[model samples]
Target: MEGISRTYPGRMHIAAMHPSTQEKSWMTALQHLKRKGAIMALAFLSTTTLVSAAEVTYERLLNPEPGNWLTNNRTYDGNRYSPLDEINRDTVKGLKVAFTVPLAPPSVGAGSFSSSLQGTPLVEDGIMYMSDGWGRVYRIDMTKGDRGFINWIMDPQTDPEFATGILNNRGVALYGNNIYSLSPDGAFIATDKETGEVKFRVETQQNPAEYFSMAPLAINGKIIIGPAGGDGPMRGRLEARDPETGDLIWTFYTVPGEGEAGHETWENNAWETGGSATWVTGSFNVARNELVWGIGQPYPAYSPKERPGDNLYSNSTVALDADTGKLKWHFQYTPNDSWDFDEVGSQQLYNAKVNGEDQLLLGHFGRNGFFYNLDGTNGAYVNGEQYVDRVTWTKGLDPKTGKPVEYTPNGGVQTYLPETRLDASVFTTEGADKSYCPFIEGGVNMFPTTYSPRTKLVYGLAIQGCAFNQAAIPEDEYLTGSVSAVDTATGKVAKRLDLTSAPKGGAFSTAGGLVFGTSANGDLYALDDETLERVWTFNVGTMIDAPPMTFQINGKQYIAVAVGPGGVGMNFEKYPARAKDENAKSMANFQQASTLYVFSL
Candidate 1:
């Protein structure tokens, strides 16, 4: 038989065989071909048999098949819940580390020394796609070995200055044969999935200071993204673009402008500089054809006197016509919020039995410490309750409207629950110290929560703390975080697991009666979804501030999480008591690094 060798472009080439050594080398060459063929067959079978592996379609995104994480939060509804149960509570204890991939820091000039692994990796067709804090996209092939190998890394080369602080990206989006990434410096890039080549780059912002750190949401041929930088002087907005061409389809300003709806809420041109940034990926209602996004705090966070009235769209959830980008309805959670209480957390969509009737509901855990259930169709308030231990900003929410009890309709310069509001005198004098619960970082921040239809419960990480806000002195603070299970119908926290250390990570719930979360102290935890009891724990030897995801390859299940520190981890000194624990202190002491740990049963 004649020995032959062939090479595929951008892939490994078969070794050339010599006629003299054909007997020995030929056999090895055949074996290599067999192995490579098996891998190619597996990839072919996965793409042909698995719905998610075929193509990133709207139908698949709306209802992703089990074992695939299509979007940042797993589904269009932003539930972050997977139906896969191969590695359930019964099997989780036996899970072992399958592999660990240490990622390099973002390029030399990417940013400050601070870099984090914050993205919720998206897995499809045996390929894993993720982004680092500085917007570098990486694609890894999981079908290769027991330990997967990185296929390619696509660095968008975003501005280094924009990569500072807590404004880095949380993830990337996948579409038909292409991956979408929004850079820290406001560039929207579409990269080829197979070769990791940049397809096109579009500037999303005109202001050099404005940027986008959230993952783009791809739906029905439109790529949706929101702006960040509300902490400074920036007007936030959400835009929809053509997925293939990166051309603008439409744009909706989070903070309305003069003569527009909600514009009157800002008194003296505050609307021009309003800071209601949409800092996280939002939930989509496929049936209603609407998209709901959470808006951040107003400009000059911590000082509401700069802008008056209810600050209409700030600290609110707005529903827009998905295709048209027109506002359908909005519900403000905190009017004229001054505690830096941004409502910019993910909105979870679910169908629930409310008031004895099946209703479409939009659920949210506000940074101000309230759990709200609203009518998903029209943005009407259905139910509201406190989901945290301490909430001093308001006595409670208005039972009918779901607004803070102290909120005055069209009110000016709100000082809700005077004692809890930031000392207005801070603008002038320095003596008064105002204390408020659910400290500034919020009851929940950028970390996305999860909802399980199987358990009919919503799981969220709640930060509990009290901050003393004075004029010039640093606000004295004490904080702790907890994992809470809330009932969908009643808007009540059904159970809570308080971590000895603060929690900056989010959670994932599975049909197998398990909820997975990581602690600030590098421990991976699997808790009983019903009882909220700890079932298993594994220390990852570093800080974990990113969410955990579950996926399957070749019928075996795996759990993956990005481990590192530095988003909210830098605030370890603010909660001394919470960090007193050995594990907590250790995590606080660890330096930041970019690493991905995958475990399997």
Candidate 2:
């Protein structure tokens, strides 16, 4: 409000003038206003004029200012580490609720199911931008002293029926003067940042059955989007579009088709409907001009017998040429994945010392219970170790090749570590049950992991415990979560904090020597980055499924996270025995609501 103008003079006269005349008239009017006794007003006008609508440039995204969170991971490298230290361990205890904004209600006629706030809020220049599970975007002004006001809300009017399960919208992207968002029914809409008016809408997916829930990644004037629908029959692909015009530029399919290099991995035309959905936002390597993304699991999630061979791209991380959409290299973590361990989680790119040598590495805390450190330039395997306590899938990864120790090259069907494999008899005409560790819920899900340069450690929220795997039988009976601090130099977990319930949220580390995260039992935690010890905890009386972010407004630092419930966090309710656990019972007692909480000293 300080730097914005109410009206521009000579608007009606300029309407009938030529282009050059209109420009001259506007300049003259501004000069006349400045000549008058309105220095403060003129200063405000100059500041507003200097702030162009197209402020989110590639350089700005690569090197974001201290107070802005331009992308989902806060930067192109996906580190999720804030440089701000005002709210360090020394001052975190002084944190109090700065403000709270309740998100819009879910779509009408939607069932009684709960809503989830899964997206990280993006803050730029004292304005916060976030979206709800129903694809409604909100722009809130955080410059209002201790409290903020919702500047505008843009609802895409997403049809709730189109979404398969509990609705979840990750967040939105900002570029130039438009904010890009995706609907549950596969529509990509661009809205005016000032008025919240729809500028253009394009249908990204033609199939009525396919939809997307993840946020779009803005890079080099292009918008890169990954599709969801991993739970159903869907072939995964990544597409790039012109951010300004919404025109298709190029598309890259994760699962190769016939005549392609990796087509032979699929049998019975399984590649056509392969469920390697790219459901999560990926990281970018500006130096190499490569887009590194993680791919999900193959189709028929639990029944690996239906599809065979080392499913090429699924359960892998692929690096493609950002300009041409061509695959440069890929490293598959799980071949012939039988446990539904999707590798479609965020990848953190950083330079680290590995085995006595400094190398640019791509790190991932995989759902399959392993921490991988790969060559960022070529996707070559460098080092990997089990980051979770119980990894029965394999004895360990082959140090040289980074594959399961028992992996057989070119094998049609894999039975690595047979003891941990799903029971073959369970899927037959006469079904039997088999138990497995690191169940289908995974050692880690889409919740992002953070890397702190100061501590040289990676922090993650990992699910602990094992579960029984049988066809059509629920697998939530045995599960829990943990917060782990892994040393990057030696792929070993230095410390761990176990949770009594499954964790759906991720962690955010800062230079302040602190790590911020939330638990399913409604407790927000601030842990020591080096020791992984809890320094502070606040119970907000609801579940937290999104990552925490920090920003500065008016020179005061603030921390914020969206709190709600009912995503994978609610899976514990299916297990009646979970009621016996205090944490699980406490989380079950609270209902989900789309509310965002911001705290400051």
lDDT of 1 by residue, 438-520 (tens): 76667887787999888899998877665553343343333567998889998888889987666767888998889998766
For model 2, the stretches where C-alpha displacement exceeds 4 angstroms are 1-54, 107-114, 423-432, 469-478, 571-583
Candidate 2 local lDDT, 1-601, one digit each (tens) = 1112222111211222355876667545754553232211110011121222346788888899988888999988888999999988788788889888887654421434445688999998878888887777777777764766665666555555555544667889988777888766666767766656666666666444366778899999788886777656888899888887677888888889988889889887888888888878999999999999999888766667778888778999999899999999999998988777899887999888886889999989889888888899998888767767787878888999999888887747798877667634333443345556675556777888899999888888887766553344453454567888878777778889887666667888887889998766667889989877788888787667887889988788899998866544554333212422555554466766778899988
Clashing pairs in 1: none
Worst 10 residues of 2 by lDDT: 40-49
Q: When superposed on Cα atoms, how far off is each prediction in RMSD?
A: 9.6, 9.9
Give per-model TM-scores.
Answer: 0.87, 0.87
> Local distance difference test, per candidate?
0.76, 0.75
